[model samples]
Target: MSLDSATVRRIAALARIRVEDDELPRVQAEINGILGWIEQLQAVNTEGVEPMSGGSPVGQAQARLRPDAVTDGDRAEQVLANAPDRMGAWFGVPKVVE
Candidate 1:
């Protein structure tokens, strides 16, 4: 599907983007280019292709996990003690905004 001027404006509004009146044409062209590329990708045949995680193909190699070890041992109190305001072992900060 091709991106039109109105659709581009609606997309920008939904994304909370503020595009100048003069820049709307450029934004529309960019969105159209992206949509055209996506449409081209949809035309490809992937009947037998398996979805892959990461750069490697599916079932190509197995991943390894590190052995369980003692990394940090009971440092909660030591960490909490450094906070500016501690409330029974928790950091306290003022409300960020309304």
Candidate 2:
């Protein structure tokens, strides 16, 4: 799928990018190179490969889960100490609704 200069200009306009007339050829060539790599990737065969869902290997055990415990509680004064405008333990903001 080769891209012409007109198609490249149209793509730039659609993406809200301002590409100069002289830069169109370079941009078009770069896009064509990316498309060529995608074409090469598509040509490879992977009939029964399982898709990876996370960084860990497929057969490895998952990471140990941390115990759910509250380490900090009842520190309202400390939490609200740096507020320019606060209302009863909460930061206050200007209302914008009508």
List per-prediction Cα lDDT, in the order shown. 0.88, 0.90
- Residue-level lDDT tens digits of model 1 in 5-83: 8888999999999999999999998988998999999999999999987978888877887888978668889899779
> Who wins the TM-score comparison?
1
**Residue 44 lDDT in model 1?**
100
Question: TM-scores of all models?
Answer: 0.63, 0.60
Off by over 4 Å in 1: 68-70, 73-98
User: What tens-digit string does per-residue lDDT give for candidate 2 at 1-98?
Assistant: 89999999999999999999989889999999999999999998978876665976587787899999988678889888998899987999999997
Candidate 1: TM-score? Answer: 0.63
Off by over 4 Å in 2: 57-61, 67-70, 73-98
Best by lDDT: 2
